[model samples]
Target chain A: MLLFLSFLAIIMIASSHNAESKVHEIAKLNNEVRELRTHFVDGKTELMRLKMESSIVKKMMQKGLKRPERPPRKIIVKN
Target chain B: MAVKEKNILNRLYFIAACMFVFAIAVLVKLVNIQFVEGDMYRQKGQERVFKTFDIPANRGNLYDSKGNLLATSVPKYDIRFDALAVNEKDFRAHIKPLCEALSKEFGKSVSYYDKIIRTARSNKNRYLLLRRNLGYSQYMRVKKFPLFEFGANRGGLIVEQRTVREHPIGKIAERTVGYERRDEQGYYTRVGLEGAYGPFLRGKEGKRKKQKIAKNQWKPIGDANEVEPQDGFDVVSTIDVNIQDIAHHELLAQLEKFEAEHGTVVVMETKTGEIKAISNLGRTKTGRYYEKLNYAVGESHEPGSTFKLMTIVAALEDKVIDSSHVVDTEDGKVKFYDRTVRDSKWGGYGKISMAKAFELSSNTAFAKIIDQNYKNNPRKFVDRLINMGLGETLGLAIKGEGKPKIPYPGDDDWYGTTLPWMAHGYGVAITPLQTLAFYNAIANDGEMVKPRFIKEVKTWDKTRERFDKEILNPTICSKETAKIAQEMMKNVVKRGTADNIRTDNFGIAGKTGTCWGNYGKDKEREYISSFAGYFPVDKPIYSCIVVIHRPNKKKGYYGSEVAAPVFKTIATKIYNDIPVIDEVSYAVVESNAVVNSYDKYYQNAQKYKTIMPNVKGMPAMDVVALLENMGLRVKLEGVGKVKNQSIKPGTKVKINQTVRLELS
Candidate 1:
């Protein structure tokens, strides 16, 4: 009876530890996913900005050297 | 006494027998507990609880030399459903809204989602994969929906993470970098630079066990066991990005301007042979072109009159002909083996110097030089050409570089007319890069270095194996011979055929080659107009070649007319961009021609001058004195310093003529 109780206790500890590790991993992955999404969005924004500027410049060139209006800077909040 | 002793002994024996039976029962009970029934008790005590999913490791990113992202991985989500866990009544009721949300997010119609959900509903034991690679934002929005808001497990919805590839500067250097694809063998592969350095880019794959919740559902057990991916090293190219942009634009413009089918322009560093800009493009019906082929090394065409530079060099190296050594043109047509090779303009160009013949791209002249020297042994000529790096394959970093086509005597393809035609850059085919390399060799003071595209192969650790410039040799001539050949080419631009490139600011020393090719159909003449040159003429820095093939008639498709101008435009831009190190001597070439115009202006000034005004602290007196010497009159008035003068110093007057003088 004493040995059986001890074996059950050990199994319970192992299962809890496994679950703990899995939860920790999920949390870390969640952070990575958040970071990647932000970066992807930023990249897209940059591409759009470049495209707009290039077309503006092209139009300006056609008009014989007029300056294009710069686009407003996006304000990003940091935690 | 005997009866009493017997009774006691029997009682002791029975007691001992009972003790042995008790020990045997205990032994059997211990065996059953420890060995036979142990597994059942252990199974009853443990519970197989929460399962895990193994998250796939994200792939590394590829960056360019300037820390610009070439390719990168972005996080994407996959939607899955655990059919077994989903309550049938509640699931069926919520299924329509869920499908509608999926259709909205995926940009698909409601019917498509219906079909997908219908099939997924068929297998209750399985976790159905709804979609793969949804954006994180899309997933977040979908998760906020009322039906999907109950969290993943309760609603039986699952999201798995994956990485997607992205190019920051799409289509720039696309062909050279290449793409990755899975082949028929089920193995993933990459091509070009990406493929060549794939191992470094791929990094190591991390392993982990995932808990299989359902047949298809898995939850990662631990920290997506991150063997934190080491990103691919940045490729620092020898190419100057600005120059590459300029070359691309100019090459495209020239190709279309000539209505040429396709063309390539490679601007390489003179000494290092580091290709700064290589623009290889093929034309399309849309007018805009794509980099469909690496024509700079892949396409080999007879380089036409440009090949004359080689023949001239060979002849000069052999001491068979000097720059002044005249070759007979006769009728400007050479009939060898019933094949008449005539100059484009026809009729004899008179008995001109060898330099003039080269300048005019005279076929007959080079034909005479080749026939006179290498005719007895054609292999000797071909061998000499090969020795000059004509037919050799340049072991460049990029694969599929063509083996340069050159004819040799006794080869099955060789004909009687081969030597003469080869002399004028025909009957033997070579790529634009090979021809450019040969010219670049001459420009590099006769030291031939193989053209290098990749400057370094960098590893993941940021350590680089630098590909230093390899000098093949001092080539088939002494520096003197190379100089003479270079100067002869310089004269071609200075006064010869390529004078169209001459600008007041820069001197262009180069050659023009216009040749007709069969293209696809036999004997349908299509011209390949090309100009190969280096500038500034005094000190060579850049050797550029512009080849415009099959230009429409409207574009005036001559090498000088089309290609030389492009060369000038690109050279001018390069000159403006690069620091001008050595100043080109812009002194008059012909000193004896005239001082007469300047003398006439001086005489007119003398005829206009008169003066001898008040000479005391008067501004006008200076002018008066100057006018006095120049035979002109001047009247001086008020002065702090030459404040006023009546007659200007330049006013016309006879010698010793008097004029009024005034002072303030």
Candidate 2:
């Protein structure tokens, strides 16, 4: 009975250590997710600034490109 | 000897009795401590092991109509250091390089950091702040710096992370995206859509019991939490980012050009009443413009000449006069009860039709007509406006909507001149949004739909609520009356005050409003210039309004000159984006001559694969593609149909042979 009790005690200690390590891993992953979200938001903001029409017009002005004055017309061909 | 022994026995009995009394006292004290103080001691011990931690839920993201992220929550970091953790030898070895790296990153002098760090080291400061609110990339760069690379033990690097709201579009629609904040008193101050939908955007917080296993590290005591946090639901607004960008920059340019105090622009979908773009820019003291306030939804002032549309519509609905009825302008000026109404034109448009009066935005004509017709019963005109829903609030989701004030006959501020003033859009207050809605009703064929901002609320892919077109009134007026009003507006742009904004590509129907602002109270009178209407006159898509306040008098102050240009810019942009599709009847016409030639070329290419075959009269582009795919490289010269080929079509197509084709 004494030997069986000691064996159970050892198993309990090992599982508790395993649980502790899992908690540490979860915390590390949570931090990584937070960092990734920050990077994504930063990149998105930069892209939006570049994609704005005003910015595009300003950039294209240097290349001597201007927006078309009138809308394009599509002619339908019947066969 | 017998006498001495009796004395010794008596002494021993006394000593034994005293020892027994002391033993009983010890037992009583032990029982008191075990029973009386046990509960308190047990509670104190539990306090050291168990803790309740708050799990914060992330605030939901804000998206535009096309699912472009407008606002989101992301973690920001603050970096600090413990000066005393570094020993003398390590500090001397790494401090120089560490200071150099930090100075390069922060753009400060190296000596500045060196001095501060040295002082902190001497003072043995445990917590020395290096930088606050660094983004993720900057924090990562700092972590790899000299001493900081060793982490918390040797380098004493301490990083604190907190979530903050970030707007992806920068300052484009910052005011509309807004934010929510709380004070120490637990009072929340919310603004814009963020404030209006705070309850939905701010998810519930959760709680969990945890045990401290190591330094600053906690382990949850159980598998399940006491309560689970639900992330906030996202709000999808109807604002189109492209339109918003155009409106913002256009308004900013006009404001800068005129040196105006402030201005606002609102574009609404005619049928659905969705606000596609709303911009409000106010000039700062430094001569820069920013979205200082939501003037489009919050500022209420006299609408000036733009209000003529409402007056004319009311008169037409009442059948007091037709569009062709002629009204004398009295050669520019007319007086009524200590107030004089003057037309901007010097000689005035004399004896013009009501439609022309409206087109010219003749103040004297409008004032004279309203005073003559509704003078006896002014309440009739006021009641007509109220019935049109012009006197009521729009009940917008955004906070701080300005209330519209329309005076009745029995009201305290009403006077004999109030009717005439109200006729030409004075002595009345309405927000830019309200005016847009009223004009949108005319554009929608008199179906007054309320202006909507948000389209749906969702959690990830699951939709919680979807907002649809909410009709404020089924019909604002009769179909005939609405048609007449629309035509009058069309004429205003076609040949009237707003003629400067007229376009040949598409038709615009709108009114120009220029009215004196803060007239009686201020020494110098200021003008508020505005333009409001819709485009493509027959079938409208958008109804827009542009209002600029207090433009420089020397540059120009007329609504047609200042505000109409912005309206035109936005209208032209929208017009130029949509392609014009020309439709034709699906009647087939047989061209036997071209078909026969095409068949002959196709048959020749397929008939002979190893021997040379005749090839002519095929288009140059088709011939190149066909020859290239069949393992023959073709070089074309000139343009149009293929006239001759250096090698015949079926010449045992050599693997590496180059065929030259001549075209005419």
**In terms of DockQ, which candidate is strongest?**
2
What DockQ class does candidate 1 belong to?
A: incorrect
lDDT for each residue of candidate 1 in B1-664, tens digit (9 for 90 to 100) = 5679889999999999999999999999999998999997776543243333233444444544434445556767787776656667767788788878878777899888777766776755356887776666677787775456776666777878766666555555556556566578958665555565555556554455455566665555544543443445445456555566568777777777677788778888888888777777787888777777778877788888999988888777777779998888888887998788888776878788898898888889888778888888877777777888887877776666777888778889788788888999988788888888888888887899888765655654555666788887666567888898888888888888888787766677789988877745566677888999888777777888888777885767678887888888788877755543443445554553236434543554454434323333334434455555765445544554543444445444577565655555
Best by lDDT: 2
Per-prediction DockQ, in order? Answer: 0.04, 0.57
Write the residue-wise lDDT of candidate 2 on B394-502 in tens digits: 9998999999999989888888889999999999999999999999999888899999999999998899999999999988888899999999899999999989999
In candidate 2 chain B, where is summed lDDT lowest over 10 consecutive residues? B607-616
Residue-pair clashes per prediction, in order, are: 16, 0
Candidate 1's C-alpha runs over 4 A off are A1-79, B1-67, B71-164, B184-190, B219-231, B285-288, B459-461, B474-476, B519-522, B580-664
Off-target runs (Cα >4 Å) in candidate 2 are: A3-7, A72-79, B1-45, B81-130, B141-157, B213-218, B223-225, B581-664
Cα displacement (angstroms), candidate 1, residue B518, comes to 1.1
